[model samples]
Target: MTSIGIYGSLGRMGQAIIEVAPSLGARVAGGADAQDDPAPIAAKADVLVDFSAASALDAHLAAARAAGTPIVIGTTGLSAKQHEAIDAAAQEIAVLQTGNTSVGVNLLARLVRDAAARLGGDWDVEIVEMHHHHKADAPSGTALMLGEAAASGMGTTLGEARVTDRAGLVGARAEGTIGMASLRGGSVVGDHTVIFAGQGERIELTHRADDRAIFARGAVRAALWLAGQKPGRYTMDSVLGDAVLGA
Candidate 1:
Protein backbone atom coordinates (compact mmCIF):
# COMPACT_ATOMS: atom_id res chain seq x y z
CA MET A 1 0.00 0.00 0.00
CA THR A 2 1.17 3.55 -0.72
CA SER A 3 1.62 5.56 2.45
CA ILE A 4 0.26 9.08 2.02
CA GLY A 5 0.77 12.15 4.17
CA ILE A 6 -1.59 15.09 3.85
CA TYR A 7 -0.69 18.73 4.44
CA GLY A 8 -3.37 21.23 5.51
CA SER A 9 -5.11 18.78 7.78
CA LEU A 10 -7.68 21.13 9.27
CA GLY A 11 -9.04 22.63 6.09
CA ARG A 12 -12.05 21.27 4.27
CA MET A 13 -10.06 19.71 1.42
CA GLY A 14 -7.47 18.36 3.81
CA GLN A 15 -10.07 16.79 6.05
CA ALA A 16 -11.72 15.30 3.00
CA ILE A 17 -8.41 13.83 1.86
CA ILE A 18 -7.73 12.39 5.30
CA GLU A 19 -11.17 10.82 5.31
CA VAL A 20 -10.89 9.48 1.76
CA ALA A 21 -7.37 8.10 2.14
CA PRO A 22 -8.37 4.97 4.02
CA SER A 23 -10.99 3.68 1.60
CA LEU A 24 -8.70 4.15 -1.40
CA GLY A 25 -6.39 1.36 -0.22
CA ALA A 26 -3.89 3.91 1.06
CA ARG A 27 -2.78 4.77 4.59
CA VAL A 28 -2.66 8.29 5.98
CA ALA A 29 0.59 8.52 7.84
CA GLY A 30 0.01 12.13 8.95
CA GLY A 31 -1.00 15.71 8.08
CA ALA A 32 0.10 19.34 8.62
CA ASP A 33 -1.71 22.64 8.98
CA ALA A 34 -1.30 26.20 10.27
CA GLN A 35 -1.13 25.01 13.86
CA ASP A 36 1.47 22.33 13.26
CA ASP A 37 4.21 20.78 11.14
CA PRO A 38 3.50 17.52 9.32
CA ALA A 39 7.07 16.25 9.12
CA PRO A 40 6.60 13.92 12.06
CA ILE A 41 3.52 12.38 10.53
CA ALA A 42 5.07 12.44 7.07
CA ALA A 43 8.11 10.58 8.29
CA LYS A 44 6.27 7.29 7.98
CA ALA A 45 4.68 8.01 4.63
CA ASP A 46 5.93 7.48 1.10
CA VAL A 47 4.26 10.54 -0.45
CA LEU A 48 2.82 13.88 0.68
CA VAL A 49 -0.22 15.62 -0.75
CA ASP A 50 -0.67 19.37 -0.13
CA PHE A 51 -4.13 20.89 -0.36
CA SER A 52 -3.25 23.92 1.71
CA ALA A 53 -3.11 27.64 0.95
CA ALA A 54 -0.51 29.41 -1.19
CA SER A 55 1.21 30.63 1.98
CA ALA A 56 1.63 27.10 3.33
CA LEU A 57 3.21 25.60 0.20
CA ASP A 58 6.75 26.60 1.08
CA ALA A 59 6.74 24.97 4.50
CA HIS A 60 4.93 21.89 3.19
CA LEU A 61 7.43 21.51 0.37
CA ALA A 62 10.30 22.00 2.75
CA ALA A 63 9.04 19.25 5.04
CA ALA A 64 8.50 16.89 2.13
CA ARG A 65 12.00 17.54 0.82
CA ALA A 66 13.56 16.86 4.18
CA ALA A 67 11.73 13.57 4.31
CA GLY A 68 12.55 12.82 0.69
CA THR A 69 8.91 12.13 -0.07
CA PRO A 70 7.17 12.78 -3.35
CA ILE A 71 4.54 15.55 -3.12
CA VAL A 72 1.34 16.06 -5.05
CA ILE A 73 0.21 19.70 -4.71
CA GLY A 74 -3.41 20.42 -5.57
CA THR A 75 -3.39 23.97 -4.24
CA THR A 76 -3.69 26.94 -6.62
CA GLY A 77 -3.25 30.76 -6.75
CA LEU A 78 0.52 30.58 -6.36
CA SER A 79 2.64 33.29 -7.96
CA ALA A 80 5.17 32.68 -10.74
CA LYS A 81 8.08 32.67 -8.32
CA GLN A 82 6.40 30.05 -6.16
CA HIS A 83 5.74 27.91 -9.23
CA GLU A 84 9.41 28.10 -10.16
CA ALA A 85 10.33 26.85 -6.70
CA ILE A 86 8.01 23.88 -7.02
CA ASP A 87 9.48 23.01 -10.42
CA ALA A 88 13.00 23.23 -9.05
CA ALA A 89 12.10 20.97 -6.12
CA ALA A 90 10.91 18.33 -8.57
CA GLN A 91 14.50 17.69 -9.53
CA GLU A 92 15.19 16.25 -6.07
CA ILE A 93 11.82 14.48 -5.67
CA ALA A 94 8.68 13.78 -7.62
CA VAL A 95 6.01 16.51 -7.67
CA LEU A 96 2.57 16.80 -9.20
CA GLN A 97 0.52 20.00 -9.19
CA THR A 98 -2.88 20.87 -10.62
CA GLY A 99 -5.26 23.81 -10.49
CA ASN A 100 -8.34 21.63 -10.33
CA THR A 101 -8.45 18.01 -9.20
CA SER A 102 -11.93 16.88 -10.22
CA VAL A 103 -11.46 14.40 -13.06
CA GLY A 104 -14.58 15.63 -14.81
CA VAL A 105 -13.39 19.22 -14.55
CA ASN A 106 -10.06 18.32 -16.13
CA LEU A 107 -11.87 16.57 -18.98
CA LEU A 108 -14.21 19.50 -19.51
CA ALA A 109 -11.25 21.89 -19.56
CA ARG A 110 -9.64 19.90 -22.38
CA LEU A 111 -12.83 19.87 -24.42
CA VAL A 112 -13.46 23.59 -23.88
CA ARG A 113 -10.10 24.54 -25.35
CA ASP A 114 -10.48 22.13 -28.27
CA ALA A 115 -13.94 23.45 -29.02
CA ALA A 116 -12.68 27.03 -28.83
CA ALA A 117 -9.99 26.22 -31.40
CA ARG A 118 -12.31 24.33 -33.74
CA LEU A 119 -14.97 27.06 -33.59
CA GLY A 120 -12.52 29.59 -35.18
CA GLY A 121 -11.52 33.15 -34.32
CA ASP A 122 -14.83 34.72 -35.33
CA TRP A 123 -16.51 33.19 -32.31
CA ASP A 124 -16.02 35.27 -29.16
CA VAL A 125 -14.84 33.09 -26.29
CA GLU A 126 -15.76 34.02 -22.74
CA ILE A 127 -15.33 32.06 -19.53
CA VAL A 128 -17.90 32.38 -16.75
CA GLU A 129 -16.92 30.92 -13.40
CA MET A 130 -18.45 30.82 -9.89
CA HIS A 131 -17.36 29.44 -6.56
CA HIS A 132 -18.19 29.53 -2.87
CA HIS A 133 -18.27 32.80 -0.91
CA HIS A 134 -15.18 31.94 1.13
CA LYS A 135 -12.87 31.78 -1.86
CA ALA A 136 -10.09 34.40 -1.70
CA ASP A 137 -9.18 35.14 -5.31
CA ALA A 138 -11.16 37.21 -7.79
CA PRO A 139 -10.74 34.92 -10.79
CA SER A 140 -10.36 31.41 -9.43
CA GLY A 141 -7.11 29.88 -10.64
CA THR A 142 -9.12 27.25 -12.47
CA ALA A 143 -11.03 29.98 -14.27
CA LEU A 144 -7.80 31.65 -15.37
CA MET A 145 -6.37 28.31 -16.47
CA LEU A 146 -9.45 27.60 -18.54
CA GLY A 147 -9.14 31.04 -20.06
CA GLU A 148 -5.46 30.39 -20.82
CA ALA A 149 -6.33 27.14 -22.57
CA ALA A 150 -9.00 28.88 -24.62
CA ALA A 151 -6.62 31.70 -25.60
CA SER A 152 -3.80 29.27 -26.45
CA GLY A 153 -6.05 27.13 -28.59
CA MET A 154 -6.97 30.25 -30.57
CA GLY A 155 -3.26 31.21 -30.79
CA THR A 156 -3.46 34.15 -28.38
CA THR A 157 -1.98 34.90 -24.99
CA LEU A 158 -4.33 35.38 -22.04
CA GLY A 159 -2.46 38.46 -20.86
CA GLU A 160 -3.16 40.12 -24.17
CA ALA A 161 -6.81 39.14 -24.41
CA ARG A 162 -8.15 38.66 -20.88
CA VAL A 163 -10.76 41.24 -19.83
CA THR A 164 -11.83 40.30 -16.33
CA ASP A 165 -14.99 41.94 -14.99
CA ARG A 166 -16.48 45.00 -16.67
CA ALA A 167 -18.01 48.17 -15.33
CA GLY A 168 -19.92 51.06 -16.97
CA LEU A 169 -19.07 52.80 -20.23
CA VAL A 170 -17.74 49.72 -21.95
CA GLY A 171 -18.94 49.67 -25.56
CA ALA A 172 -19.51 46.54 -27.59
CA ARG A 173 -17.63 43.44 -26.43
CA ALA A 174 -14.09 43.55 -27.77
CA GLU A 175 -13.21 40.98 -30.43
CA GLY A 176 -10.86 38.19 -29.30
CA THR A 177 -11.14 39.26 -25.66
CA ILE A 178 -11.26 36.23 -23.37
CA GLY A 179 -13.73 37.55 -20.85
CA MET A 180 -14.10 36.17 -17.31
CA ALA A 181 -16.94 36.74 -14.84
CA SER A 182 -17.05 35.53 -11.24
CA LEU A 183 -19.93 34.77 -8.89
CA ARG A 184 -19.68 33.94 -5.20
CA GLY A 185 -22.62 32.63 -3.21
CA GLY A 186 -23.87 30.48 -0.33
CA SER A 187 -22.28 27.04 -0.43
CA VAL A 188 -21.77 26.37 -4.10
CA VAL A 189 -18.65 24.25 -4.49
CA GLY A 190 -17.57 25.23 -7.98
CA ASP A 191 -18.98 26.00 -11.43
CA HIS A 192 -17.32 26.87 -14.75
CA THR A 193 -18.68 27.48 -18.23
CA VAL A 194 -16.90 28.50 -21.42
CA ILE A 195 -19.16 30.10 -23.97
CA PHE A 196 -18.30 30.34 -27.66
CA ALA A 197 -20.59 32.97 -29.02
CA GLY A 198 -20.84 33.68 -32.73
CA GLN A 199 -23.35 34.58 -35.37
CA GLY A 200 -26.52 32.48 -35.15
CA GLU A 201 -24.88 29.59 -33.26
CA ARG A 202 -23.27 29.18 -29.85
CA ILE A 203 -21.48 26.42 -27.98
CA GLU A 204 -21.07 26.11 -24.24
CA LEU A 205 -18.82 23.75 -22.28
CA THR A 206 -19.53 23.46 -18.58
CA HIS A 207 -18.49 21.59 -15.42
CA ARG A 208 -19.98 21.76 -11.95
CA ALA A 209 -18.50 20.27 -8.80
CA ASP A 210 -21.19 19.61 -6.20
CA ASP A 211 -19.22 17.70 -3.63
CA ARG A 212 -15.79 18.45 -2.19
CA ALA A 213 -15.00 14.76 -1.91
CA ILE A 214 -14.62 14.45 -5.66
CA PHE A 215 -11.62 16.76 -5.56
CA ALA A 216 -10.27 14.96 -2.50
CA ARG A 217 -10.57 11.62 -4.25
CA GLY A 218 -8.84 12.98 -7.35
CA ALA A 219 -6.06 14.38 -5.20
CA VAL A 220 -5.45 10.99 -3.58
CA ARG A 221 -5.54 9.34 -6.98
CA ALA A 222 -2.95 11.85 -8.19
CA ALA A 223 -0.70 11.15 -5.22
CA LEU A 224 -0.84 7.43 -5.94
CA TRP A 225 -0.07 7.99 -9.62
CA LEU A 226 2.79 10.39 -8.89
CA ALA A 227 4.64 7.73 -6.88
CA GLY A 228 5.48 5.84 -10.08
CA GLN A 229 6.68 8.74 -12.19
CA LYS A 230 10.39 9.66 -12.61
CA PRO A 231 11.63 12.64 -10.62
CA GLY A 232 10.51 15.79 -12.46
CA ARG A 233 7.80 18.43 -12.52
CA TYR A 234 4.37 17.12 -13.53
CA THR A 235 0.72 18.15 -13.72
CA MET A 236 -2.69 16.55 -13.26
CA ASP A 237 -2.46 15.63 -16.95
CA SER A 238 0.58 13.50 -16.23
CA VAL A 239 -1.16 11.73 -13.38
CA LEU A 240 -4.26 11.13 -15.46
CA GLY A 241 -2.15 9.50 -18.22
CA ASP A 242 -4.58 7.89 -20.71
CA ALA A 243 -7.26 9.14 -18.32
CA VAL A 244 -6.07 12.66 -19.17
CA LEU A 245 -9.74 13.49 -19.51
CA GLY A 246 -13.04 12.23 -18.18
CA ALA A 247 -16.59 12.65 -19.34
Candidate 2:
Protein backbone atom coordinates (compact mmCIF):
# COMPACT_ATOMS: atom_id res chain seq x y z
CA MET A 1 0.00 0.00 0.00
CA THR A 2 1.11 3.55 -0.73
CA SER A 3 2.00 5.68 2.25
CA ILE A 4 0.71 9.26 2.07
CA GLY A 5 1.73 12.26 4.13
CA ILE A 6 -0.51 15.26 4.70
CA TYR A 7 0.50 18.91 5.10
CA GLY A 8 -2.65 20.21 6.72
CA SER A 9 -3.75 17.46 9.01
CA LEU A 10 -6.30 19.35 11.08
CA GLY A 11 -8.36 20.95 8.33
CA ARG A 12 -11.50 19.52 6.82
CA MET A 13 -9.91 18.38 3.56
CA GLY A 14 -6.98 16.83 5.41
CA GLN A 15 -9.28 14.98 7.76
CA ALA A 16 -11.32 13.80 4.82
CA ILE A 17 -8.22 12.51 3.07
CA ILE A 18 -7.19 10.62 6.20
CA GLU A 19 -10.66 9.11 6.52
CA VAL A 20 -10.76 7.97 2.89
CA ALA A 21 -7.13 6.98 2.38
CA PRO A 22 -7.52 3.49 3.81
CA SER A 23 -10.44 2.68 1.54
CA LEU A 24 -8.27 3.71 -1.42
CA GLY A 25 -5.56 1.25 -0.30
CA ALA A 26 -3.30 3.91 1.11
CA ARG A 27 -2.09 4.53 4.67
CA VAL A 28 -1.21 7.77 6.37
CA ALA A 29 2.51 7.86 6.87
CA GLY A 30 2.22 11.06 8.85
CA GLY A 31 0.69 14.54 8.92
CA ALA A 32 1.66 18.08 9.96
CA ASP A 33 -0.31 21.19 10.80
CA ALA A 34 0.40 24.92 10.50
CA GLN A 35 2.62 25.08 13.53
CA ASP A 36 4.52 21.89 12.77
CA ASP A 37 7.43 21.16 10.47
CA PRO A 38 6.40 19.28 7.31
CA ALA A 39 9.88 18.13 6.32
CA PRO A 40 9.72 15.13 8.63
CA ILE A 41 6.46 13.94 7.15
CA ALA A 42 7.68 14.55 3.61
CA ALA A 43 10.77 12.49 4.30
CA LYS A 44 8.89 9.32 5.09
CA ALA A 45 5.86 9.10 2.81
CA ASP A 46 5.64 7.80 -0.74
CA VAL A 47 3.84 11.03 -1.62
CA LEU A 48 2.47 14.14 0.06
CA VAL A 49 -0.90 15.86 -0.26
CA ASP A 50 -1.15 19.51 0.72
CA PHE A 51 -4.43 21.18 1.68
CA SER A 52 -2.83 23.89 3.73
CA ALA A 53 -3.00 27.66 3.42
CA ALA A 54 -1.30 29.36 0.48
CA SER A 55 1.05 31.14 2.86
CA ALA A 56 2.66 27.85 3.79
CA LEU A 57 3.15 26.61 0.21
CA ASP A 58 6.78 27.55 -0.06
CA ALA A 59 7.75 25.64 3.06
CA HIS A 60 5.77 22.59 1.99
CA LEU A 61 7.31 22.63 -1.45
CA ALA A 62 10.73 23.03 0.06
CA ALA A 63 10.15 20.09 2.38
CA ALA A 64 8.99 17.87 -0.47
CA ARG A 65 11.90 18.90 -2.62
CA ALA A 66 14.40 18.22 0.13
CA ALA A 67 12.97 14.74 0.57
CA GLY A 68 12.73 14.05 -3.16
CA THR A 69 9.06 13.32 -2.71
CA PRO A 70 6.14 13.90 -5.05
CA ILE A 71 3.41 16.25 -3.82
CA VAL A 72 -0.20 17.01 -4.68
CA ILE A 73 -1.36 20.53 -3.88
CA GLY A 74 -5.08 21.27 -3.48
CA THR A 75 -4.72 24.66 -1.86
CA THR A 76 -6.65 27.63 -3.28
CA GLY A 77 -6.36 31.45 -3.20
CA LEU A 78 -2.84 31.40 -4.51
CA SER A 79 -1.14 34.33 -6.16
CA ALA A 80 1.01 34.56 -9.28
CA LYS A 81 4.18 34.42 -7.22
CA GLN A 82 3.08 31.26 -5.49
CA HIS A 83 2.42 29.61 -8.85
CA GLU A 84 5.88 30.64 -9.96
CA ALA A 85 7.27 28.89 -6.91
CA ILE A 86 5.38 25.72 -7.77
CA ASP A 87 6.69 25.91 -11.31
CA ALA A 88 10.19 26.30 -10.03
CA ALA A 89 9.77 23.39 -7.64
CA ALA A 90 8.45 21.21 -10.46
CA GLN A 91 11.85 21.35 -12.09
CA GLU A 92 13.12 19.02 -9.37
CA ILE A 93 10.13 17.21 -7.85
CA ALA A 94 6.85 16.01 -9.25
CA VAL A 95 4.20 18.53 -8.28
CA LEU A 96 0.50 18.57 -9.10
CA GLN A 97 -1.35 21.72 -8.14
CA THR A 98 -4.98 22.43 -8.90
CA GLY A 99 -7.56 24.96 -7.79
CA ASN A 100 -10.11 22.26 -7.10
CA THR A 101 -9.54 18.54 -6.69
CA SER A 102 -13.03 17.22 -7.38
CA VAL A 103 -12.91 14.85 -10.36
CA GLY A 104 -16.18 16.32 -11.65
CA VAL A 105 -14.75 19.84 -11.64
CA ASN A 106 -11.67 18.79 -13.59
CA LEU A 107 -13.88 17.07 -16.15
CA LEU A 108 -16.02 20.18 -16.37
CA ALA A 109 -12.91 22.20 -17.15
CA ARG A 110 -12.17 19.89 -20.05
CA LEU A 111 -15.70 20.20 -21.41
CA VAL A 112 -15.58 23.99 -21.07
CA ARG A 113 -12.35 24.12 -23.03
CA ASP A 114 -13.78 21.95 -25.79
CA ALA A 115 -17.01 23.95 -25.99
CA ALA A 116 -15.17 27.29 -26.04
CA ALA A 117 -12.92 26.14 -28.83
CA ARG A 118 -15.80 25.00 -31.01
CA LEU A 119 -18.29 27.75 -30.24
CA GLY A 120 -16.41 30.60 -31.94
CA GLY A 121 -15.73 34.08 -30.58
CA ASP A 122 -19.28 35.27 -30.99
CA TRP A 123 -20.34 33.16 -28.04
CA ASP A 124 -19.81 35.12 -24.86
CA VAL A 125 -18.32 33.22 -21.93
CA GLU A 126 -19.10 33.82 -18.26
CA ILE A 127 -18.22 31.99 -15.06
CA VAL A 128 -19.95 32.16 -11.70
CA GLU A 129 -18.96 30.37 -8.49
CA MET A 130 -20.01 30.19 -4.86
CA HIS A 131 -18.38 28.77 -1.70
CA HIS A 132 -18.96 28.70 2.01
CA HIS A 133 -19.11 32.02 3.88
CA HIS A 134 -15.82 31.40 5.71
CA LYS A 135 -13.88 31.10 2.49
CA ALA A 136 -11.49 34.04 2.12
CA ASP A 137 -11.07 34.51 -1.58
CA ALA A 138 -13.34 36.20 -4.06
CA PRO A 139 -13.65 34.82 -7.58
CA SER A 140 -12.53 31.48 -6.11
CA GLY A 141 -9.67 29.75 -7.83
CA THR A 142 -12.06 27.28 -9.47
CA ALA A 143 -13.82 30.19 -11.17
CA LEU A 144 -10.54 31.33 -12.64
CA MET A 145 -9.73 27.76 -13.63
CA LEU A 146 -12.95 27.59 -15.64
CA GLY A 147 -12.29 31.03 -17.12
CA GLU A 148 -8.85 29.81 -18.16
CA ALA A 149 -10.46 26.81 -19.80
CA ALA A 150 -12.85 29.03 -21.74
CA ALA A 151 -10.05 31.35 -22.76
CA SER A 152 -7.87 28.41 -23.78
CA GLY A 153 -10.69 27.15 -25.98
CA MET A 154 -10.67 30.51 -27.76
CA GLY A 155 -6.91 30.40 -28.17
CA THR A 156 -6.55 33.34 -25.80
CA THR A 157 -5.12 33.64 -22.29
CA LEU A 158 -7.34 34.26 -19.28
CA GLY A 159 -5.34 37.40 -18.50
CA GLU A 160 -6.39 38.93 -21.81
CA ALA A 161 -9.98 37.67 -21.93
CA ARG A 162 -11.12 37.74 -18.31
CA VAL A 163 -13.43 40.45 -16.97
CA THR A 164 -13.94 40.17 -13.24
CA ASP A 165 -16.08 43.19 -12.42
CA ARG A 166 -19.02 45.09 -13.90
CA ALA A 167 -20.80 48.22 -12.71
CA GLY A 168 -23.31 50.76 -13.91
CA LEU A 169 -22.63 52.26 -17.35
CA VAL A 170 -20.09 49.57 -18.12
CA GLY A 171 -21.55 49.35 -21.63
CA ALA A 172 -22.05 46.16 -23.58
CA ARG A 173 -20.09 43.04 -22.71
CA ALA A 174 -16.84 43.00 -24.58
CA GLU A 175 -16.68 40.57 -27.44
CA GLY A 176 -14.78 37.35 -26.64
CA THR A 177 -14.33 38.25 -23.00
CA ILE A 178 -14.88 35.74 -20.18
CA GLY A 179 -16.79 37.27 -17.26
CA MET A 180 -16.60 36.07 -13.65
CA ALA A 181 -18.72 36.51 -10.54
CA SER A 182 -18.33 35.11 -7.03
CA LEU A 183 -20.89 34.45 -4.33
CA ARG A 184 -20.45 33.46 -0.69
CA GLY A 185 -23.04 32.15 1.73
CA GLY A 186 -24.26 29.43 4.06
CA SER A 187 -22.43 26.10 4.02
CA VAL A 188 -22.02 25.73 0.30
CA VAL A 189 -19.24 23.30 -0.51
CA GLY A 190 -18.84 24.76 -3.97
CA ASP A 191 -20.93 25.60 -7.04
CA HIS A 192 -19.64 26.57 -10.48
CA THR A 193 -21.45 27.31 -13.74
CA VAL A 194 -19.98 28.27 -17.06
CA ILE A 195 -22.28 29.97 -19.53
CA PHE A 196 -21.85 30.37 -23.23
CA ALA A 197 -24.30 32.82 -24.73
CA GLY A 198 -24.68 33.27 -28.46
CA GLN A 199 -27.05 35.20 -30.69
CA GLY A 200 -29.84 32.65 -30.74
CA GLU A 201 -29.05 30.25 -27.93
CA ARG A 202 -27.14 29.61 -24.73
CA ILE A 203 -25.28 26.71 -23.11
CA GLU A 204 -24.52 26.19 -19.45
CA LEU A 205 -22.13 23.70 -17.92
CA THR A 206 -22.28 23.31 -14.19
CA HIS A 207 -20.61 21.39 -11.35
CA ARG A 208 -21.82 21.28 -7.81
CA ALA A 209 -19.62 19.96 -4.98
CA ASP A 210 -21.81 18.67 -2.18
CA ASP A 211 -19.09 17.19 0.00
CA ARG A 212 -15.40 17.76 0.75
CA ALA A 213 -14.76 14.03 0.62
CA ILE A 214 -14.94 14.07 -3.17
CA PHE A 215 -11.98 16.40 -3.28
CA ALA A 216 -10.12 14.26 -0.75
CA ARG A 217 -10.69 11.15 -2.84
CA GLY A 218 -9.50 12.88 -6.00
CA ALA A 219 -6.44 14.26 -4.22
CA VAL A 220 -5.46 10.84 -2.93
CA ARG A 221 -5.98 9.33 -6.37
CA ALA A 222 -3.82 12.06 -7.82
CA ALA A 223 -1.12 11.48 -5.18
CA LEU A 224 -1.00 7.79 -5.94
CA TRP A 225 -0.74 8.45 -9.67
CA LEU A 226 1.95 11.05 -9.09
CA ALA A 227 4.10 8.93 -6.78
CA GLY A 228 6.03 7.09 -9.46
CA GLN A 229 6.20 9.83 -12.08
CA LYS A 230 9.33 11.66 -13.16
CA PRO A 231 9.87 15.15 -11.82
CA GLY A 232 7.45 17.54 -13.52
CA ARG A 233 4.28 19.53 -13.03
CA TYR A 234 0.88 17.85 -13.46
CA THR A 235 -2.84 18.42 -13.22
CA MET A 236 -6.01 16.42 -12.62
CA ASP A 237 -6.26 15.84 -16.36
CA SER A 238 -2.91 14.14 -16.08
CA VAL A 239 -4.15 11.94 -13.25
CA LEU A 240 -7.40 11.13 -15.06
CA GLY A 241 -6.48 10.46 -18.65
CA ASP A 242 -8.71 10.88 -21.71
CA ALA A 243 -10.09 7.38 -21.28
CA VAL A 244 -11.25 8.08 -17.73
CA LEU A 245 -12.37 11.58 -18.64
CA GLY A 246 -14.33 10.18 -21.62
CA ALA A 247 -12.67 12.75 -23.81
lDDT per model vs. reference: 0.84, 0.92
Question: Which candidate ranks first by lDDT, i.e. highest?
Answer: 2
lDDT of 1 at 243: 56
> RMSD of model 1, in Å?
1.7
**Candidate 2 lDDT by residue in tens digits, 125-215:** 9898999999988889889889889989999999999898797789988898989999999999999999999999999999999889999
In model 1, the Cα lDDT at residue 216 comes to 90
Q: Could you tell me how far off, in angstroms, the CA of residue 34 lies in candidate 2 after the best superposition? A: 1.2
Score candidate 1 by lDDT: 0.84
* Model 2 misplacement above 4 A: none
Which pairs of residues clash in candidate 2, taking residues 3 or more apart in a chain or in different chains? Answer: none
User: Best candidate, TM-score-wise?
Assistant: 2
Go through the candidates in order and give the C-alpha RMSD of each one to the true structure. 1.7, 1.3
For model 2, the local distance difference test gives: 0.92
